[model samples]
Target chain A: MDNQTKIHIKNLNLHIGKQQILKDINVQIPKNKITVILGPSGCGKTTLLKSLNRLTDIYPDIKVEGSIEIDGQDILKVKKRDVTDIRKKMGLLSQRPYPLPMSIYKNITYGLKISGRRRKRFLNKRVEHYLKQASLWDEVKDRLKDPASALSIGQQQRLCLARGLAVDPEIILADEPTSALDPVSSQAIEEKFVELKERYTIVMVTHVLRQARRIADHVVFMYLGEVVEQGSAEEVFGNPKEERTKAYLRGAFN
Target chain B: MKRFFKINRKIRNTFHKRWMLLSLIVVIAMPIVLGVGLYLKSAMLLEQTSLIKLLFSKEWKPMQGLFGLWPFIVSSLWVTILALLIAGPICLLAAIYMTQYTKKYFLRMMHPVIDILAGIPSVVYGVWGVIFVVPLVSNHLAPFFNTQSSGYSILTGAIVLAVMIIPFILNILIEVFRNIPDQLTEASLSLGATHWETVKHVLVRKAFPGIVSAFGLGISRAFGETIAVLMVVGNVTQIPKGIFQPGYPLPALIANNYGEMLSIPLYDSALMLSALVLFVVVLLFNFASRMAIIKLERHT
Candidate 1:
């Protein structure tokens, strides 16, 4: 219940069909900081990220147990209407950018318009504001009316980031958001996350150890669907208390 | 050894090339053969009355040797347009529901039923239309609208055509909707848009070209459907005054007159001309629809 804690997870468990995906998870994500969930592939990092926003609800026969309290509301117990409201409060940057089959400008404004911001001037201003925030304004300012899919993969991902931010979410859930991009685009996103940490809570999932090291303020190192270590990035990376954490940091089983 | 292998390859290549040429000629020649025959048969009619007069004039008395195609042309177009108006929205809604909203198990069950509906013979549709739809229109709809009570009319025919084409349209639209990548919907849903809103704004916009092609396919089917339409659309030759009145479409005219065409002077030629006209119109419609789909795709 600390004012600094944005999300408090307690005894979270997720099962898809007969297989357990996330086992007895518990963590605290702080406000205005980047929390990186670092693990090897298939270690449930992405599932953990998705769990925060209830995106895992789309999977069939999936059961989620325990509480994920965001802003004093246990999202698991909220009604469907309130779940949507909660989802709106969290921005999700997927691994691949899906630009809503619309013009670049419309992609940013769609969420704003749906939330009932209809003034032409307001929409125009926010479109510029968010695109700049995602660091894609200069590259795409001339093509605001063009189809978003026409952009390069890097630009598309940036556009998606701007789109997510347009909704004015308190938290940004990114699941390996730069895994599909080239290194340069990857660096651009990493820089954007570093700058955005002062304004919004960011929970990112990544299999790449280097990325986790580059941008993690808080680190949760997971293995085999269980959290092995959770602490400040410096403590976990510089001087790990757990032997498993030490092994993972040393690239024992990447 | 290399020369022997080379000769073997040459023999195989020559055989393949000859077979390809023969099949290609057969495919290309069939349509031309049919078109040529149709043109020759209609030549007599062209000689009897100018092509413009045949196409444009409304008057039609075979005994008096005046045959204008305005009535048949008008009836054919109106019936097809009406059928599309009724079927297009229903097919689109059903397709969207099946692809976007329905459970996987339910969609699996519904798909075969839709396919069977598409596979049903058109004659069966005509009979069903007569038994069920004609009465519904005459007993209920006619009384409700205060229109004429005849069970057979342009409206009745259109209703039958609409029923027959809905399944056809739905099948195409369902395929189009299914091809939309999962990431797009996930993005929309994650952004907090409702399922309906996602479908309306994202899925529909992405699938616009395919939807256009689906409608085009549906309209083309409705336009050319022969046996069932002939049975339902009351075959009077004058232009229909309203939906309740009997009308004569070109297919019904050709179907009713083709058998006795040889006995009547210029009748064979007129019937053949109508067939040719239907072919040309349907071809143009399909071609135009393809162009529209391409334009929309490029714009997106």
Candidate 2:
């Protein structure tokens, strides 16, 4: 595997029920590095993330024309099996934690069970490893069998992170993981993101500029479904190349 | 000057106390009134029949001092359960389609379709069943069920009841499914789960209490339905050994026999006893519905 162009998104266009949403987007995601997609609400950052895994394909009446490639294999043109295989290499954590109506242990392991392959020893080790990685091992280890919903919102979000990590995906897509959390909780999640960049390429969509600035290794600024600019986090924040990025950072249009 | 503060303080103090007292009275009074009403009504129903003696005699003729209700009770329950068997899957499929797979236009059209089916009179349904559904079943469903009779049996009655009450179950179940958050569905689908899998694991799992309540309500609705059932079910007072067997439900018996009974205490007592059973069944149904709704509320 050439260590370049881990994920390539080219000429991406999206429409929801005949209204054009995202247009003419092109981006390259580098391997083993965080690429935070920063934008205002309804600016299509989340939509771009969802397209990588073809998650939007599930929505009926959704029109999409895009070339998203992973490791030089165009995922959209490839067979659904190949696409699902690619999806396994990419994990997603939504804005809010969605713990299944099951035990915490099972919630973390649901994806595996649904795929119809289970390994007890591996699952146990993976569960503990990911939980510890998400910094939720101590708070929930004693009550692994308890309902995941019993945990507080912050803990649930962390638990979801642990769940996503359990799949051992190299690329993690987090859609505003801390948006619904308290300040302290948000800080904790941000800290986790900073530490996670060593092992995983994390693409986080955050409306909060401070959060993006704090943890983003590379930043991709998007507005109205187009990437305005993308570069090293320091460069993007300190000297934004595009006017839209400047306007967004300065709290003008969302 | 202090009067204002004192009055405000009194209001604050009494808000919780008064609220609790009001709710408590309302809650406690309803059951009390219900219990007294049931007690009076049941006593009145039981007075006509020698309910105590009838239990031991095992004979089912009120004219001959034998007032057994075992067959009627059995038939009533048997019809309801049979009707549920016939209708449950149809309503469940309808619910799944309505909730998961349906588009906005289809959903918009659903109300009218359900409304038309629901608004059709029981007698009209009876007529329809006799004219349309019965022949269709006799030609179609009966072949599969394989009954000796060409038409008019427990199977026919249950199918009629099923057709009549399916919309009711669907309406209730749709509300239950609707109450479940769309976020749950989105969350599951985003995880690469299929439509049925999402429905089974997320949608149905989330809406279990509501579905159960629908079934209970459906059972209650089917239990008391008289006209349609009486029209189709061959009203013989047999054990209803099978769906194809001719049998009489409690309601049908009441509707048919209520007219013939005159100036006879036994006749009236039998009627009252059946009414008492119906009342108890209804009360239990309501209690079950309340419990399910409470459970659903907690689930949300």
Candidate 3:
């Protein structure tokens, strides 16, 4: 119920058929800060991130119980017709970059065009603005008309980030966004996130502890579908309260 | 014992390599052999008449030795194109719905149904056309459009041909839609685009080349279909001016006349030329489609 909480999860549980993926979870994600969900593989980090924007609805046999509130609205209860509006409030970055099968300029304009933005002059300006925001404007400004698939993997990931940002979302959810990139590209994304946290509520999921330590303002450590600890970066990383968290930070089992 | 076994294994390996090499050579030579044989058999007609005249003229008297093939060529083109026009949209939409909208279990259930449809004999399809499609066209569709015609017409042949090729085209399209990675769909959806929008902008765009090749293969299959089409398409030698009119296609011409061709002087040669034409047209179509797919792949 705190005013600073951008997203509040209450008793949320998810099941795929008979297998439970996420246990009853309660957490408060603050506004204008980087909240990193840190966990090892198969620990439901990506699943928790996906549930924020209702991306899990695409999967069959997925039963979600309880509420996921964003801006005081329970997104889980929104009707099918209104889900797109709910999704429009969040930008998501996946593990791999999947550029639209289109030219680079069109990829950025796709989100704008679908939202009924038809003015060519407006679209052209926004494309450049978002590319600049992602720090990729100079590298790709000349070849905007080329197909997006022609770009290298790092450039393509940047293009995807630019495309997501063009939607003008209030929150950014990234699921291991740098796992597929080289170290240089990974650092670029990490730096961009640190800068972007000033304006947007960023929720990132990553198994890389080094990444979690670099930019996370709020850290939520999870294990076996349960949140083991949640607090400020200093409290969770510097002053360990839970034994599991202590063991995990000390180069224990992944 | 170990030395003897090693020597035996070396001999077996050589035999295996030579056997594979011979099989590869035979596979490579099959098409070449077919092309050469068809050319030689059709050489007599080509030597007697100019290629342009034989292809462009429409005369068809056996006693007078006139064998123009323009009408048959036109009929074949009409039937194949009409069949594609009928089946193309239906198959594409069906494939998208099956892969994108339906559940996995539903798609799994449809696999065997499509296979059975494809496996049914062509003669069985011909009989079905004679019984069902012919009446539907002449008694219902033609009358509704204020036209008069016999049950057997090009329209009937196209209807039958479209049904026959549906399973083939649908199978390829299903695979094309399914092969597109889920990541693209997720990216589009995450941008606040609806499911329909994501499918239109991303999935269809990515699958464009595969869809083109699928339809191209369908066109080739419909072009050479003999039994079902031959039964429904009225064997008139004149060019068909409308879908309701009877016409003769190249495959039907060869099938219907090969029995009596030996008695006529140049009839046998003309029939062989008809077969040759079918072979070359299908070959050209397949080659063109492969080129289109490659160009699309490079662009994307």
Candidate 4:
């Protein structure tokens, strides 16, 4: 394992029901870098992202083979008691924003309260910190008491990001975080993703190639449950690579 | 002129936009219209007792000139509360298990069983309660209280009603739990909360309105259920001292006497009055629940 490697997938395979979904996947997600997984929909980008934190284990009858490790601690071997601990170290933003049917302030501090921080001032500061980090603090600072759902779609997504950041996780897994947003909203989220990469390691799954170009430091291109190409974003996007990757970049299948 | 037909087009398009609004207004107002109409007709038939007597009437034996209904009214409330007490936890937990913990096959298996139970006639539930439940409680539960027998007791009716309404609670809760987006549950669980904690804090909280409505629906169904209560309730029309005591509900009392009303307007009026009482209770329950939901909805 490289010293900079935070998550390593070795010979990983997954099957949902009778269909083999992820096949022989091997990747090492680097620390403090924006690594974007780009692929067509249903090509297992989200599944691979979920496998890092063992979120996919919530489903029954899915067969997973090989090993996934975070900080060289094999996540699959982690017991049920430690799942939360492992999950706490990583935060996931779904494709759609679900900002908890709670007040915006409460939404940001949700992860803290259940972790047993009952102090008033500390929780308040943490809420303000993350909300600002996601760039939604200014827009929503006055309406902190209002329901998070009252915000516009873009604001809701940012609030979800703020909520994710509240836990102080080392890695943030974003599954198509901006796919559901308009271009302006998408750009807003993209800039935040770039800004946060200095402090937090981000593994993002996106269907849009342009999104990968705009934000990713490194890119992992997947097709049919296999990694076709992966490199620094500049190299992967600029230089020649696998035929399938080139075809995909050309908008051959959309 | 071309402009003339375009004005007709504009009118037609405007009507299309308003159609759903019109439909919503009509659907929402239909029940109020029906209820108000029934109330007016019943008001014409029922002689107004003073407010106190109307509410506190005891010993509702119209045949013998005792036309107070406080006993049956209290009995109905008690039985509905009891059914909720017994069925609420079981149905909700079972619904939780079905919705969250278990797989599709298990849910597929359990759902139809609940549907079949829900579909079973009230009479069948009564027969089953009398044959099996009454015996089980008398043999297993009564001895704990040092009672000789609680045959056809309040406990028996409550148990029967609970069983009858189990599917109702479970079915509606199943729908409510299912109505929540899967992402909601996943979001909570991925936050590192345990499955139980997610259910308590997220799933149940989000579905509170739906669950409460389901409960209100259950209470209304149990309150209005007659044949099942009549068969197993010991047919004693008085306020039950406790779970082990015998009791009768208003619906059961009405069902028992509905066939025997011959000529007297008071007898027919009393039955109509009781039916009107049942209608009023149901209407108030629904309206109050709707108001409560709206108030809570405003806060949410």
Candidate 5:
């Protein structure tokens, strides 16, 4: 109920068929700051991020029991017709960038067009604005008409970021967005996230502790589908309260 | 011991390589062998009449040795094109619905149905057309449209042919749609696009080359389908002016007249010429579609 909280999760449990994926998770994502969910692989970090925007509904036989409230509205309770509206308020960057099968210009304009922004002049301006926001304008401004797949992997990821930003979302949910990028691209993305957090709430998931330490303002450490510890970066990393958090930071387990 | 094993492995590798090379040679030689055989068999008719006269002239009197193939060629084109027009949209939409909108169990249920449809004999489809489609067209459709004719016509032939190829085209289309990666769909959906919009903008767009290739394969199959179309298309050797009118396609001509062709001089060769035409057209179509697919792949 804090004024600074952008998202509030209460008793969130998710199950796929007979196995539990996320169990009784209660957390608060703050406004205008980066909240990094740090965990080992297969610990449901990606699943938890997917749940924030109701992307979990895409899979069959996924049973979700909980309330995920964003700005005091329970997103999990929204009707199917209104789910797109909820999703529109959040931008998602997946593990690997998947550009739409289209030109670079069209990929950026796709979300705008779907949301009924069809003025050609306005769309042209927004495409440039988003590409610049993702730090890819200078390299790609000349070849906006080229197919997105023709770009290098680093440029494609930046294009995906620009495409996501073009939707004008309040929160950006990135699930290991730089895992597939080279170090240069990864640093470029990390710098963009740091700059972007000034205006947008970012909830990122990565198993790389170094990344979390570099940019995370708040850290949530998860182990085996449970949130073992969560606090500001200084509290969790500088002086850990939980034995598991200490063990993990000491390179005891991956 | 290791040296002895190495020598044995080298001999085995050579033997396997030669075996595979022999199979590859046979694969490459099949169409060439068939093309040569067909050309030799049909060369007699080619020698008797000019190719232009045989292809363009509408005269069909076998007694006088006049055998123009214009009517049969036009009829075949009409039937194949009409069938494609009818089945293309239906198959594409059904495939989209099955893959994108429906549940996994629903698609599972449809698999056996499609297999059964594909497995049924063409004769059965022909019989079904005679019993059902012919009457439906002759009684309800033609009368409603103010066309007065027997049910046996180009329209009936097309209807039957469309039904026969639905499974063939649908199977390929489903595979095409399925091959599109899930990440693309997720990217679109996360952008706040509806499922239908995502399918339209992403899935269908990505599957375009595959869809074109599937349609090309379907066209080749429909063009050569003999019994099903032969039964419904009234086998009159004339250019069909409209769908309601009866027309004779080339496959029907070859299949129906092949038994009696031996009695007439050059008659057997004429039928063989029709077979050659079918083979060449299909080969050319497959080649053209493969080129289109490759070009599109590069562009995308």
Candidate 6:
């Protein structure tokens, strides 16, 4: 959304077991804009997105060496007690929508309630607000109390987005959020991401070149665990600097 | 060679189908036949004596022709409830820890240990209860609670039952927890929930129906447990006054009295009725649990 840098990933090397998944990556994610990490499958794109919020810490064999600073605080070096606070500043939409096994109302309120929001009026208003932001309020307004799984896949994805937004995160991390969706559903999510870019910093992972071209404001093209090129969307998509990036854009191979 | 191989494959398929059908018939027919036989025998006893008198009368004198089952019923309920109360929380917590928190090395070590625990015979558990649990409760747990017990009491049986059922219920719970997708936990964690919070809100909520069914199965096992319970409960055919007092559960009563049933007039029928009651109770619980699991599967 602006020229100001919000997240700075420096010399981030990630390895699972003996396999190196991310090799000395460095990138600056701008604030309040959609930064799409474009790469082939299994090329450490999801791994990179996961490390930004310290989600990779859950894996026992994972070793991460580097610092990821958000808003001048090195999240990688922060105390374990502060991880929750750090995570609270960002939301994530996974490849598949996993709505908490509860009513749609409770799914949105679960994060709020755990973060210590407990007023009925406030929860109601916030639920409506988030649902509207995801463009799901009208479709699900009458059945807010229904099980979230009862909705269609597209609706569930939007509901997942609403649930993520209800936490009031400053940034959104989506890992191939629309790959599981149909064309119409993918379009809906793309449009929502465009609308959400005005308020939240979004970093998306996508293997689809056209999707990257359509929704990316800033582009970071990664190949085989390395960032080949990164710049404004126009420059990277239209005039890629690296041969690997050009070959990938030309659909030589994924 | 190719025709010979095809003939071998066809033979294997036919053999497999035949075995599957045979097992299904054996499994279904045995329970139905036994249940009907037991029901008819109990029906004869019901006709000889009023159902109310058989159910409500506290006097269970076989010599004087009384067949009341109130005390045994009460004992069964009390012992099962105590066993479940003791085992349920410990088993659930152990299951959650094993699935959610245990390291891979520990988990590998634990799987065989749990399997061995599950495979140990009920008769072996009975012997162990007599030797170890009885003394522990009478000498330690009873004294700790400032009560006098002679080692064979409802509390002792309950403790033994609890130990026996933990691995049983825990096996089911671990499987249920494992079936939950990793994405659900990731979603919760990304929303700023701690590991424990994610477990409490997401994992537990997702697996609740399965957990409930596991408990139901555990309860049914406790209800029908005869050998271990008979060893520790001090079978006294009377309502227990306290956790330290002896009690007579239905299975124990039947197991103890079946040898002398032919000597008494309607005693065999009474014992069979008790068996019928146990069967029906366990059946009801299994059915409810099946329904709950199905509903959960359909929902998710």
* Rank ordering of all candidates by lDDT, starting from the highest: 3, 5, 6, 1, 4, 2
Better of 3 and 4 by lDDT: 3
Clashing pairs in 1: none
* TM-score between candidate 5 and the true structure: 0.94
What DockQ would you assign to candidate 1? Answer: 0.58
Worst 10 residues of 4 chain A by lDDT: A54-63
> What is the fnat score of candidate 2?
0.16
Per-residue lDDT tens digits for candidate 3, residues B113-159, read 99999999999999999999999988999999899879799999999
For model 2 chain B, where is the 10-residue window of minimal lDDT? B49-58
True contacts kept of 5: 0.58
In model 6, the Cα lDDT at residue B48 comes to 82
Q: Model 4: what is its DockQ?
A: 0.45
Give per-residue CA lDDT, model 6, range B192-291, as digits (tens): 8998999888888889888889999999999999998998899997878898999999999999989775888888899999899889889998999889
Candidate 1 lDDT, tens digit per residue, A57-121? 66555689999999888998887666668889889998887788889999999888877889999
Model 2 chain A: which ten-residue window has the lowest total lDDT? A80-89
Candidate 1 per-residue lDDT over residues B1-300, each given as its tens digit: 999999999999999999999999999999789888999989988986899899989988877777899899999988999999999999899988887765567778988999899899999999998898888888998889888657788898999999999998998998999898777887887788877788889899999999899888888888888888888788888889888778899988888878874666787788889898988888788999999999999877
Clashes of each: 0, 0, 0, 1, 0, 2
Judging by DockQ, tell me the better candidate of 3 and 6: 3
- Estimate the TM-score for candidate 2: 0.87
Worst 10 residues of 1 chain B by lDDT: B98-107
Every candidate's fraction of true contacts kept comes to 0.50, 0.16, 0.70, 0.38, 0.58, 0.62
CA lDDT scores, all candidates in order: 0.88, 0.79, 0.93, 0.83, 0.92, 0.90
Error of 5 at B185 (Å): 1.3
Ranking by TM-score: 3, 5, 6, 1, 4, 2
Model 5 residue runs over 4 Å out of place are B1-16
Candidate 5 docking DockQ: 0.64
Docking class of 6: medium
Candidate DockQ scores, in order? 0.58, 0.35, 0.77, 0.45, 0.64, 0.64
Question: What's candidate 2's DockQ score?
Answer: 0.35
| Reference-based lDDT, residue B270, model 4 | 63
Model 5, A13-41: lDDT tens digits are 99988899998999998999999999899
